[model samples]
Target: MSAAKIGDINLYEILGVEFEAEQADIRKAYRKKALECHPDKNPDNPKAAELFHELSRALEILTDISARSAYDKVLKAKKAAEVRTKQLDSKRQKLKADLEQREKDASYIQSYSTVPKTDEEVLQEQIERLRREGSKLLEEEQRLMREQLVRTMLEHQYAQAKTSCDSSAHRIKLKWKAEKDKSNGGYSYEDLTIFLKKYGEITALVMSKKMGSALVEFKTLEAAEMALTYEKGRLQNPLHLEWVSVPGVKVANETRGSILDYEDLVMRKLRQAEERQRLIAQMLAEDEAEG
Candidate 1:
């Protein structure tokens, strides 16, 4: 019976008979299976008819003496191959299952354990973030540092400037005599104070009348020069503005001037005026001679 290959599905297993079964045994098994799988008996099962045909074919092949002998050698080889295939298949499936289990175990261990960061990795992460964000952080830090340095330098320079201004010649005393006055009220302190405020910063005010003039002190040299040389400005009745020295008493009283200080101031001013007039007269004489 050169019907099928040796390694195909076993016919004995299909017929429910052992490999060592007798012909009578094969016949009995075949009859039982044919009845169970018959078209008339199992009308609802479509495969029943096909199974009946295959079983009948198997029975015919096995019951004949010559066919059975030929099939027995092939069947033995088929059984051995089947056994080897089943062993190899089982081992392969088991190895696949073990590999899957190992992967699952590794994943579980890694999920709970944290990877410690290396310095290079941390630096690399920072580099990546900086690439995305640009150099704004570095620029902001530099800007802040520059601002702080500027502020510190400005504060120091401001302090030095303030000290120099304080120590320098900001104060200048001014003496002025009225050219023509009714003596009723030639220069009132109130009017002078208000007028001076428009031009410069004034910290203190003093008026002295004992020296036949008013002695005034300004907080700034520019203010004293302005009051002395202004073309249209005057205290009252043709005021003669002159530079003088700062006196000991700050707020000089017009009605009660000290005797020694008043006399000295008067003499000094009179000498200065006479010397100035002499120089002017000499200059005028020289000019006329040249002409």
Candidate 2:
């Protein structure tokens, strides 16, 4: 290699050895690399001859004591120059970033710098803002009231429908107080059979051993109603009658005997919403008339 190209060439890299490698290690690396790119071994490759010559030259420079020392000086100078160039580039980038930030700050200040509003104009703006806020608050209040009214109406309707359905059904389930006597665990199916049968001909009797309750299905609706009148059936414990809750039963009118098939719950929800809107409109109309 020429003296001018000394900075461009790295002998250690060409020989595939570290700069601090021993002479024996450098020769070993060079031999291994030279075989890979030997002209005879890679006859079809045009770059093989050039690579093989470069490897030979690199090995010659790296192995010689005086030549290796001179090349090391050139490599150090090249690295120093690269570090200085990087430092200068970094400083230039930092200066450019600072200038851009200053320009942005100046632009922002210029955009906001305008003629100040009069006292009356500022007061009018405040009034307009307050008016908008007041209107929003009033709307929010009305929305909340409508939601609350719908919820209350739905609860009332559910209670009324359940009552009507239970009154019309021929089955009644009652919960009895837990027995105080430790000897008797709780009410069994056999214990309450005779007492429940007295009201009417019992179709079915289900005893909940755990809860101490019984569900009696009677042949006639009147029989079920009569059972509720007893309150406590022969047993010392007081009985509380609860209507059976069948799934999908939204209203009493839709039920047939014990088997109930009600309208879609979605329809009921929509109807309740419509009722709430009607009530609100009626109230508004009355208020306007009074005004």
Candidate 3:
């Protein structure tokens, strides 16, 4: 006996007998099936003649020993081919599953190797990460502090220079330092008078053509001081202004020096601030270690 074929019709099935049935059994099965399918017996049935014809052919093939032998060999070969195809498909699926499992194992091992093995090691990694973040934040804070301090100092200096006056100076004059390369085209005497007149009435204007410098005497001391404030405001690198040298000039308390040593002061303050933070951090770390 065998399982039924899925696609093509089997001769044994047409005769309504098992594959291993004897010739007598096959003939008995065919006789019974033929009676039910004969055109005369099943008149008005459209497929009655077709079914009877197929049964007759199956009986003819199975009764002849040579024909049955040939047909059995062909059926067996087809079954063998189907079995080999199924086996190949199963092997391909197994190979794919094995490959996927190996890749999964390799990835797991790689990731597992990077993980800290001990609780202490994991704690240390976390501490190191926190330390790096803290240091970055501290550095950024210092940078912002430095910029703010510098800006504040510049503003203070400008304010003092704008208001303070040296009453004892022989002349209320300001010296303009104009670098040769800075002058787009040399500034004219008329240009200086027009520009300086805004700060105060200019009593005298003298230009040193060779040196590319100018000296202006204001009508009042307040205007000269106001003009001096611009020294820190906009007249930077190539252009600068300072009080003209006077032997017994009365320097105001706030505007004693031409330039302040603000950079050194700012640096010292920053260093002290950093030292305090460092000590605090050290104490925290020591407490953590004790805990």
Candidate 4:
């Protein structure tokens, strides 16, 4: 085997080591050489300047795991090529011997001979077989490549989502409270309308006299944060402010139900009507007793 040629003073030579040297040895070598060839110490020598640059490159590769792995692959391929050359020589010798033996036996054929398929037919069969094998291999390779691409995309998305969540500056929570006026019956639709006009938008209003509360969602954490801040001490007559951030606000209905439902307002009006009727009935009973 010919000795490996060294040309153009490269990183390995600048570090005074073989290409396959361990990282620790590379580092030690770099430190020694960097001190010796540092431009400040070797100001008069152009060669020292070149050597310093080469040492820098060597240290960069040695310190980086990925760069070192890539360089190692190159060395492995070179070694594999040498092994393949020896194997090819052995294969050629065996094939030559087999052909010679076949040629000698060619003359011992039987007199009764049957016609074989034409060369073109044999060639066509071989071509078809190869085509089928190639097609299967291509499909398998394509599937694997697609799977790798999908995994890469998912990793990218997860990284982006993580970054966004980490950088968020504010957090907001929603709170709900239910209030009733038994004397007036139920709450008024007019009051809710006036509230929504004053407030940005109503997120949700569910009315079952048994349960009355609004579920409001904000577009941004900042907006929600602001709303919770400003509305803390504010009160409208007959309605006081009580806020808490609780979980279990159904997200899907926030979009759909908000558009369709006016039930909360309607129920409030019904309750108020019931309260008014009760008061009127009581007054009439008192008047009849006096008469």
Candidate 5:
């Protein structure tokens, strides 16, 4: 209670007793407050010892006639000072909040309302800058392709070397596009094992309603790879395989996408990017000649 932000809680407030309380009433309140704030009673509370000491001091001053009168005069002066301190804090906080609001308003106006003017040279520079940005994107895409290739090689090496299945993503999660028969819900673990054997060899197969699909762990990574290729149903089940590792596939289509389609997409994007670069170069050359 001698420390800052501690003794600010008035002695009367801490004891929760009225200012005009008699010695007997004050004594009773002190005992209750002391018991509640006692070091022995509150082992978890670090502030219990300080509060107990403060309670003892309050009781000592209030119990004695001379000490009580002296303490009352000091308490009255402290209360007046505390009130003034609180009023000033509140006023200062209000002024600080208003200043912050004004700064925020000024910042918003400066950011959105005011636009800087640029010359023809700046415009040409901006146009030229876009070509570098576009080239960077294309370069990033190439880097990604190289990384993907290296990753594929490393994954292939790891899969072939390891006898035990990949603990992380050994399982292939696939959802049925159509309604399944619930009558055959009484399937055992052994039955699931037998069912998954149709799609290459698997370590385990688990069906879950919560997952909304069947999770089948391939015996080898090659098996999982083969299963992924079967986007459309090869057999009667009509349930196309999708890897759990794939982020999104709420519902996989019955139709499969060919490698040719993927290649065509890459070609289209490359052509578009090249066309853009050609236009940019032409514009930059004309700007340089004019300048």
Candidate 6:
């Protein structure tokens, strides 16, 4: 018989016999059906051809005792395996549902057990902690300031003699010479402007193109003396000042006049400030749109 014909029909049902029926009973049932549904008797009916083929295959297999017994055993094993698979699938589904329920219960318990802190409470706690830390920092800063003041007083006392005014003109020049000798004269006029801003006011200043030496005058002798005493020996570039007793010499020019124009620098700074404000406004607009 054809493989498709065998594949399409349940052989036991085609024979009209139980799966456990004897070979004789199977043969009897198949003969009766084969005669009833014979293609030769119903040549005009197309379905009679299919039923005849089924009956023939069923009779052929069932009539053979060995083939019938082997087929019965295979069918029994297949059915048993299908039942076992269904039981295993049921167990798996039940276990999965139980695990999911346990996880959900655990999540619910965790959510309810701890109440979330409010934004205000959290912010207040952070603020108080920061305040405590700031107070500690302030105490440390005050202590450091006191210590620094005491150290500065001691250094000032030690270096006091170098800054004293002398009676002899030659001795005063020698003192200025000694202070000048201690510095490295490599800094530009721009460097002096920064130094003056920090240390003392420059009352009168002059820079000569030929000598390249800067002459700076301070408001008081003490201010000039302080600059000569403290900054003279400390700077790598020699920034020295001689105590000229001349009068009516107030107008002075900066050494690097091209680089230190007040108008040009102020304009550049204002332009930068405007550009920064424009960028900040653009960022705020983007944030508002997103919100």
- Point to the candidate with the largest TM-score: 2
lDDT of each: 0.53, 0.58, 0.54, 0.45, 0.53, 0.48
- What are the candidates' C-alpha RMSDs? 44.6, 32.4, 39.5, 24.0, 29.3, 40.3
Q: Clashes per prediction?
A: 0, 0, 0, 4, 0, 1
- The TM-score values for the models, in the order shown, are 0.28, 0.31, 0.28, 0.26, 0.27, 0.28
**Which order, best to worst by lDDT?**
2, 3, 1, 5, 6, 4
Using lDDT as the measure, name the better of candidate 2 and candidate 5: 2
Model 4 Cα shift for residue 248 (angstroms): 14
- In model 6, which regions exceed 4 Å deviation? 1-9, 88-291
Better candidate by lDDT, 3 or 5? 3
Q: Write the per-residue lDDT of candidate 1 for residues 1-291, one digit (tens) a residue.
A: 123432254668888989889877876776667656767657899999888766765665566554456566656765775676577777786886688699768866776678554333343444344445554433443345445444444444444443333212333333345433554245567756776666576655555433223334455566766766672335354555554433333222421444444444344434543553454455445535643
What lDDT score goes with residue 131 in model 4?
Answer: 41
For residue 239, give model 5's deviation from the true position in Å.
67
Estimate candidate 4's alpha-carbon lDDT, on a 0 to 1 scale.
0.45
lDDT tens string, model 2, 2-39? 54464467778887788799988876786667656767
Q: What number of backbone clashes does candidate 1 have, counting pairs of residues 3 or more apart or in separate chains?
A: 0
Give the 10-residue window scoring lowest on summed lDDT in candidate 3.
165-174
Question: Model 4: what TM-score?
Answer: 0.26
Q: Model 2 off-target regions past 4 Å?
A: 90-291
Worst 10 residues of 5 by lDDT: 247-256
Clash pairs of candidate 2? Answer: none
Best by lDDT: 2
